[model samples]
Target: MSAIKVNQIRAKLRQLFEAHLDLSDIGPTDGERENKILSRCLAALAIYIQTGCTEKEAAESVWDGGDDNGIDAAYFDPSDLRVVLVQSKWINKGAGEPEAKDIGAFTKGVRDIIEQDNTGFRAGLHAKFSDIALRLSSPGTSVHLVLVSTGASVLAKHGTSVLTTLLKDLNGDDPEPIASSEAMGLAEVYSGLANDPLLSNVSVDATMLDWSYVATPFPAYFGVIDGLQLKTWWKTHGKALVASNIRHSLGSTEVNNEIKQTATSTPEKFWYFNNGITLVSNEALKAPVGAASRAAGVFSFRGASIVNGAQTVSSLAKVDDDNRLAEVRVPLRVILLKSAPAGFGDEVTRTNNLQNRVEPRDFVAQDPEQRRLRQEMAIEGVDYQFVRSEDSMATATSCELIEVTTALACAAGEPNLAVQLKTGIGRFFVDLSKPPYKAVFNAGVSGARAFNAVVVHREIERWIDKKKTSMTKKSGPAWGALVHGNRVLSAAVFAKYGSGNLSQAIASFGAAFDPAVIEAHCDIVHAKMAAGIEANYPGKFLAVLFKNPSMSKNVFDLACA
Candidate 1:
């Protein structure tokens, strides 16, 4: 957490706590009531401030009280396969960092959750038991253990070491694991919530270019935005303005390192050296600046997303408070797409971000099928969201792309392909523009049906993960040796169910199939696959089998045999 606790914002946090936590039913004495209120209030406030989940959800998500086992708030984000365990403290007495015992308690609670022994947890967790159990035991689930305190002190040295060891254990042999400890003190809490009110209305100073016009698809503009103006824009709008960017402003990258260096060292040469920021807005209105000419203009945009130059814009804002941008200016381009067709903004984002060397995941938004799927799912009365970009997937009401892709592939009669896609996304997902990538969307699966399949697919995954957990714990090395081809094992289960016929499996994907039956079938398929892997690729075969698609098909066949 950065050192930025404003007194006014601290008061706001207190006000929020007071409004949400009512201790009328819990404690009789004044001191007891205050303690109860503080505990509950801290839990709710931590969830509300840090996540995009609603305040109502935040309030109900709190699991801190009697027999809490040191857990405050637990949020399971299915979209990202992450389980966030939040521990909160309201230390208004200027107490230093929380004692090591508190950190140890949190770590023990996480271990308990992973082991499925929630006996001492708060009673409120019973209401969210299924969600918590599924996420905690799900395959490849990552943990984010966070401790939010209103005290100014950072974590003690011993507390940090305890958390680091816990993280290492949680990650195990998984390659793409994100396990970490976050200590959000007063400074970060205030900075996060205080800036939202000031960004509602942004007024920029620029000359409207005379030649700006609506060209068939959308309106476009070219202008000079003073460096001071860019700083003001970022300060007011903050990260929200670039929420659709491929990636957020990661501090001091190879590119942003240059941006910070140039913005401060040579502000005059910035315009020539740096490429301009690209923005998409719902509407753009040109304002008169001196005399408007075809060459330059000032424009005010609504509902803006900075699709490019997020790094430069963020870096420039960092150095601007020191009057480094007094004489600096940068060129900017604005595109207004008020009535643009579906997925057009995504296309613009992909095209521009490609130049910035963004990851291939950003290009997922360029597919028009996602928009169509969303529309169709809405019509079917299912609030299923299919997201393409990284930010939308994280913060919006959207499903993970891999989840949808796997579900659809399995439904299209290619369970092996589904398994390959799920396990090998890092190696194969970068080529979404090519044939096999396009086939995931063009498999003739309807949005309503695919959404239903995804639900079933997740349930199946949960069941299989439970089996894996039980087997591994009982005989660690023996089970590990048996499950050499674990990546495609679930797909083999589905492939056997489909009998190499995708249409039949899809048609069977409704409320008719009993969950008990699905779990039973998965058990048989999983066991057979484990044996097949042990007999075939007995020692360390995942590195090669998981690298290519055809290897997954071979495993599926062995499981079927």
Candidate 2:
């Protein structure tokens, strides 16, 4: 997939060179080029969705001037109901990087459509204008909200921290403002080198373009599939494609149904059927060998909510019947496995991988079945506790993550704490990725299980390292190996932007990033958890920058000093 992204970037650059347009005529900085690249890429996707070809098919749109409403171009996929409405802008460099400015625009546009109940440009795809409008705020819905030149890189340092937090909220960050200033300490890498200027300058560098951000990458065109198959695609029914909902990752209920129907989908794992109403494991829903479990998603890869040098999962619940209340915890986790990839060894296990990384995403692109085979082999040697969640999958919510983590306090196993099991990315976050390190049985666990372990593995640091090592090759080693390689890099800065999708802006920046950065962060985060640490925070790293402007320098660099 990464290769595919590079190819797309390369081809775009090659076309520019082939045209031999006087680079001097385009006297704008790299940020301008980043904007163009993103617009063109999105234009290409719109065209492809409409005509099943590249943007060249709709070349005229590239020149169309956009307005405050923000539709640079549009496309209609005649086959399915997919209508692609593109709204993009070349905002203030990286400062605009998926920050409140863009979100405000998007939210306004969607709300206007809803309020007026106006039929947008009619398209030929299976997508309906009403559904598209509804997707504006609904989770488990499919929408490609493309915002180019809106990411933080466009701005100077102050804006970077602010915008980063804005992106986190869209992908499911905690209610608390992020530690924008706290994460500032990480500005070094994204910051930049001498000749390269600040990371802010190259934040829109097309030089690092890749196709994963594209509608479809090499080997497979997921967008095309969804475009053609979405109307009838049950899996993609309530999904959206943004910085967050990239795949058909649904909420707890959808996952629960998936798990229940396919509890026996794989022998090594079980579906965890609820007491008949939902996907919770009861006596009848028991696993033949292992136990059933529910899962959650690692929406943001940054320190979504950090307080006093600690990662805060959530503080949703407070004091329960069992006396376990207050500090909320995410259920994601990645266990160590002997069989990883060709370059994999014991050095890159799930535990080590999640310690420092954010949402590790490499494993997501693999063959689902093959990845499952690997998980079966690996879990064979590990011990697990078979526990069931009190809720069904569909109704499973943040409360579930809290419940599972709290429930695990009573869990125990033969050797190590029983690794509660779930499936897919949802389960993986709750399973091998989140910190609870216990098993849970609920309806959501079943559906996530159906997606198979690859989805789950993709969120794991070890799996991310395997994918990163296989995909990226550099003389220098990764920052945290299993840690920093799997997550996003954010620093606490002077300001923390409100919430929204940052990918569109980053993509428009002719986006190219070290995959290791995303992976390493996920790994580091997972590693930081002790056998029992909570994932809850009520402070913002960027709050300091806003509360006290005296430390502007520290805020810019994201340094605590």
lDDT of 2 by residue, 1-561 (tens): 333433344344335322322223233675566556544443443333323333344443332232323344444332222334444433323233344554455444433332223323333211434344434322222223333332232444544444344445323333222112111111211221111211111110011111112122211100001011111112221111111111112222233333322332331222122111000000111122222211211111110111111111111111111112111111221111112234322232222324432232223323243244224323432111112233423211111232232222212111011111211123333334234331322222321222222112233434444644564432112322222112111211101210121112222211332335435544443233211111221122221212222322222222212
Candidate 2 positional error at 158, Å: 11
> How well is each residue in 1-561 modelled by candidate 1, as lDDT tens digits?
222343444456556655655444575755666555665666766666544445566666777766778888888654235577888876655346667888899888776665455566655565575477556544445567878876754788998888887776655444444466788777666655664421323334444333456576466766666677777777776656676666545443334546666777887888788788887777777666633356665566877878887777877776744577755667678777678887888889899877546544556667776667767666645554444444544211235666777666655444455554544443334566664566666536566655665665676777856765676242222343223334465555565566223333333444455667657767776666556556765543243344346655665676667
Given candidate 2, what's the lDDT at residue 244?
Answer: 15
Local lDDT at 550 for model 2:
34
Residue 95 displacement (Å), model 1? 3.7
Among all candidates shown, the one with the greatest lDDT? 1
Model-by-model lDDT, in order?
Answer: 0.61, 0.27
Worst 10 residues of 2 by lDDT: 275-284
Can you tell me which runs of candidate 2 are displaced by over 4 Å? 1-68, 71-87, 90-103, 119-131, 134-146, 150-561
Tell me how far the alpha carbon of residue 451 in candidate 1 is from the true structure, in angstroms, after superposition: 18
